[model samples]
Target: MATVSEVGELLIQKQQTITSAESLTAGLFASTLAEVSGISAALKGAFVTYSPEMKEALIGVPHILIQRHGVVSAQVAEAMARGAKYQTKADWAVSFTGVAGPDELEGQPAGTVFIAIIDDHDEVHIAQGHFAGNRQVVRQQSVQQALDELTNLLSKN
Candidate 1:
């Protein structure tokens, strides 16, 4: 898988910026990008919306969507990606929302995750994942998966 630094380099080469809206992984997605040197030139910003209210207020994810689909659904993930793109005004954006738990959420089992990516053209791609581990491990795996997915998508673009 491509590293976050490699993704940053590609974005810089394309003269584009990227942003992230995170939930279960917190700011891990953004944190990984920020770790790359000179990423500020291509990484516009990131929003760590760990709560439903912040997701709605900060990233413009609709409360209704969250209510209907719950926080860890594909719909919420897609909305978050689009919302992050708008909020950051970046050429690309990614969002992650999921249940990384030792328990279930909204009838979904633990380790259920949804990762979404939105490009400049408004095209959105989503991937569903189920990881095995404790809460921390699930969250860490989610971040790695999200970064890998974003790297792959950016590479394609």
Candidate 2:
């Protein structure tokens, strides 16, 4: 898997940009990107749509879509990435949505996460993961996986 720094380096080399929409991992995805030196040139912005409403209001996710697939599902993850892409006009956007908790959410078990990537072309790719750990560990894993996905996607381009 590619590290966040590796992703940042590639973005810089390509002269592209990125944005993030986060839920389960909060700002970890964006924060991690920020940790990479010289990333400011590539990271357009990021949003933390922790609330279901914000996913719609701030990120432009459709209410009916979330209602149908639940907030933690891949559908919502894709929508979140698309929204971030639309808002930031970045060359790439990543999104995270999941249940990272001591309790279930919308009947889904904890550690259930969906990660999505929307490339400049607006094509969407999604991945689902079920981690086993406490809330912090689940979130950490989500952030790492999200970055790795972005790295792989960038490598492809």
Candidate 3:
């Protein structure tokens, strides 16, 4: 099975909840987690903020961070994850932001995705993935990577 389902099973077993803040992948990351059976036991909520203003206003990403690192950078993804964790009161939170298209954003290449996760211990992790595909493929790969990372982190704990 895909890692999202595995992550769901682990989260259920551990009784941990997760929330999500999405940008480039939109809600694909959250939707993948929700696709797993019995995910409600651990799934908290999912927020789709595609715009920088929305990322800042909805997820509480700092304006200064966005100004410095741009919305597609790892810093914004980290802040978004942290903000989602606090906003949803979930044990863990994740954020996905980047350029997944035929065009570039803030000078970053397309298919560049930054996935960030905040564990229950308040530890944050970020990963940057470069994919070669259309918009759909990039989004799908990003979701898979995020789920895989979540599974790996859970294994360590």
Best by lDDT: 2
TM-score for predicted model 2 compared with the true structure: 0.97
lDDT of 2 by residue, 86-107 (tens): 9988999999999998899999
lDDT of 3 by residue, 35-116 (tens): 8899988998999999989988888999999999999899999999988988989999999999998999999999999999
lDDT of each: 0.87, 0.91, 0.91
How many steric clashes does model 2 contain? 0
> In every candidate, how many clashes are there?
0, 0, 0
By how many angstroms RMSD does model 2 differ from the true structure?
A: 0.9
Residue pairs whose backbone atoms clash in candidate 3: none
Candidate 3 lDDT at 23 equals: 91
Candidate 3 residue runs with Cα over 4 Å from true position: none
